[model samples]
Target: MIKNLLLSLIFLTVLSIAVQAQEALFGAQQIISPEVHDDASVTFRLLAPKAQSVQITGDFLPTVKMETPRGTFDGPGKADLTKDDKGVWTYKSEVLKPELYNYSFIIDGFTTTDPNNPFLIRDVASATNIFIVGGGHADLFKVNDVPHGSVTRRWYDSPGLGMDRRITIYTPPGYENSKDSYPVLYLLHGAGGDEEAWINLGRTSQILDNLIAEGKAKPMIVVMPNGNVIQDGAPGEGSKGFYKPQFMVAKTMDGTYEANFKDIISFVESNYRVKADKSNRAIAGLSMGGYHSLHISNNYPNMFDYVGLFSAAIMPREDATGKIYDNFDGKLKAEMDNGYKLYWIAIGKTDFLYDANKEFRAKLDAMNMPYEYVESEGGHTWRNWRVYLTEFAPKLFNQ
Candidate 1:
């Protein structure tokens, strides 16, 4: 009896070990042909060991419902994976609509990858594969020759924030003429991004230069300011990811953002030969920057005639009993209708802020305000903002 019990215990332990080993090695491998036409379908394949289950999950197909075949199986919109005679596994997914999707594979409860797709983006700690269904708008990195705009790094003193902030400005071709005074667009960067973001990551200078040269856009000055307040020195000068906590706190404070605007406006007026009037001044930004633009412009309605919010964080409200624009009173509504040539709000269809922008747009509608709301094929990325600036610039100062 003791010998039999010992033998059974050893068998169970060995089986547990084997099961763990199988779980570790039984992950799904690469995906093939991520993008497909809206009307058409594409097959996705994965590599796995025999007798293991593989499931695909993503923004399009959030649930792990479909199974992949063991070896190189093709199906419509979905597939099942099982082990083949060769000990390999594969599955194909169906055609999807035109949009950006984030997808991953699950093998025995462990998430895996699709090695076939090249377009991947970092999602915090882990990496995920991105697939685009339809064609996208013109990218900033893919710009052809147009009179290019140049970006400059400038330092400014912020008395309110008690830090020396850094700002970036984009000057169009002929800006060196000294006799020329150009309209200025004060663009703000979002959280986790600095003044350089508009030029480096956002590629605002390239987009403006290309658009201006091609006669697709009018030449204008773009000023990008570092929006954080807790940093001791200029933006991008401190430790990376260090200012994040302070930025988060400052973002919620209306006064802190107002101080940033004061510093930026003062710096522009002091340094550049810019048209300082409302007619020639504009303010725009994305995400947090969008929120800043909305509040700053509305607070000081006389400061900017063109205000743009790309994926804005704040909604439009006329009940300004305690808010920044409370001083504008009925004039806020009247000026919005007439004084501003363009009050534009743009967001991507798949962006997290799509619902926010929609709610804000509805608020504008309730107030009977005049503004332009645009929805395109993208998320909260530089691709959308670059195109937004390109399209928004020409419409400005034209009237």
Candidate 2:
């Protein structure tokens, strides 16, 4: 009996090993193709390991759709998956429109990738493959001979967090030639992003230079700062999303951003030739950065005269009620009404935080606060933030 039991146990262990091997072989799967012209139609092909249910999700279709053998996926395009003798699955889809899109494959309840596409972007949780509908804007992605701004990375000693932190600064046209001081805009990046995001991905400096050259925007110093707190001796420490337990424990929503604000203000005032007055200083950011700007500016009423929040996340008003006045009552009345020169909020209609932005706007209206609210075409993306900065900059320093 003992011998028989040992043999059965060995057989089960071998079976487990085989199953694990099959799973590992599956890895991540995806489809590949480039963004085609708007008038031209193109096909995208995806390869998978086995016969599994796969769906295509992209900016065009924010939701997932089943992969069909030869039918359209219910939008401007369609997808078909076929299998070859080698046990590889292939899927093809027709070209739709032109725009920057993010897409992925979902297999057996897990998000996978198309092994064929070389374009990808790294986020906090996973990497996503990118496909452009048409070619991207030349000014934003490519370096040009036109006057441009430089993005510099600066490290500073943070006494509050007991570690060094980094920030990205964008100096506009004529910044180097003149001894005259310029107004500064402190731009904060969202969660899962670093100081480099606006400069690298958003093309902030280029957009500003082009806009200013066209007389559409005012030339100013744009400082993009890393909002994450680092402890002693910790290298590359940062916060990306609110899904992690540490992020929640840190109460990223809780008004701790004053530490980052103080560091940025001190660094800019001491190191750069910028106008140090509240009227000349502005603050703006996207998502988590938007939340930070709202809290920080309100808490320090005298620090910034202009404040912009793109897709701002207004948290629950602390009283578990639907009233915004309960939480921001005193500050909303005292700081935003009298202290700010221009308070602006811009958000897309499809953004997840649209409702919260609307509610906050209504609260500001009730307090008779003077501000600007703008709604545009896209969701939470750099596409919208780039345009937001272009429009918002021109309105600043006018008084």
Candidate 3:
């Protein structure tokens, strides 16, 4: 009995020490960096007594113009944070919209994520803290009280690429339980992104789950493949061990990916219970993925009935080769003659590729090709891409 009491005391002492250590590491007081107010305004806080200057950069703020080799486009805005006597820096915004936003803290010229905010998303190599201001469009992006879908990281052999590659597939709710076959949407990622891009930063699964549960979108399978042909998968996911991801990867826009896309389709149709016909098939993507969607749909001519280009790169690179990149007029004409359910194109007003898209549209007009165009406010951003998906998915397989 004495030994038992002694052991109990020791356990209590160890628990107390652990609690004290945790308190010392993360402070005794809880710090809520992002406090959303009733009026839709958000306030951010950070505790760093030794720091001289602190600034917050987020998508909610007005965009700043950035000049690049491509063209001038808008980038995220930054604001200064006021420090109190207690060494806590705080910044309050006027009013934020009901959409998801990502932000980072800049301390003494170095950029860092908010320690207080646990929710984070990684795009390429950079990681940012993300939060959704509920009650509007972001509602679909949230994981609400709805029937969730299954996201699987599957691998398949690519005979064209000559390597086993990774793919992310989203099977809708009631998919596994029921033997009902569903339509498939071949959703591709942008240049720097891999198969994991749409699942993570794009919030594809959450959006699909909420939309499908609400009956806003039909239950369908979404297949996201890595556009970069050189790599088997996303960074650290392939043979490479945790290598830094870059904004540019090799063989993204080349004809290689478009030529080998059949392998992905074959894998999906064979593995999953899908309606393996053109009328029940849809293909869409953003930027380079968009370019691929355009070319792939045209090349196949009878594969996808619905095609979407969200801020797509309109043309191939100057030095790009391959028959897939050749005879664009002939390919598009063949696709138009074959007929499709919907040809949709969406782009931001200030997007650098806006003019190129306009030119592409004019070419379509010359051929009398029918296509739907949607122009939103922001330039080359995930916010616009998510919005596009919400709008695009509903129109698929409806006809």
Ranked by TM-score, top first: 3, 2, 1
Give lDDT for model 2.
Answer: 0.67
Worst 10 residues of 2 by lDDT: 70-79
lDDT of 1 at 179: 73
Each model's TM-score?
0.63, 0.71, 0.94
Top-TM-score structure, candidate number: 3
Clashing pairs in 2: 29-113, 30-113, 30-114, 31-46, 31-114, 192-240
**Strongest candidate by lDDT:** 3
**Tens-digit lDDT track for model 2 on 171-192?**
8878888898889998877766
Candidate 1: where are CA atoms >4 Å away? Answer: 1-140, 232-236, 239-253, 315-331, 334-338
Cα lDDT of candidate 3 equals 0.92
Count of backbone clashes, every candidate in sequence: 16, 6, 0
Off by over 4 Å in 3: 1-20, 25-29
lDDT values, one for every candidate: 0.68, 0.67, 0.92
Writing each residue's lDDT as its tens digit, candidate 3 over 88-195 gives: 999999888899999999999999999989899998788999988998788989999888999999999999999999999999998999999999999988877999
For residues 1-399, could you state the per-residue lDDT of candidate 1 as single tens digits? 999999999999999999988775554222344535456454556555443677666656533223444222111132356556655555445655544456676777677667667666542134567655543434333445555666788778888777676778898888886578888888887765666667765668767887677676667889988766555433336544333233343443344665457777888888887888889998999887897787788767788989999987664433323345454436457567556778998998867677878877876788889898889875776657767877888887777
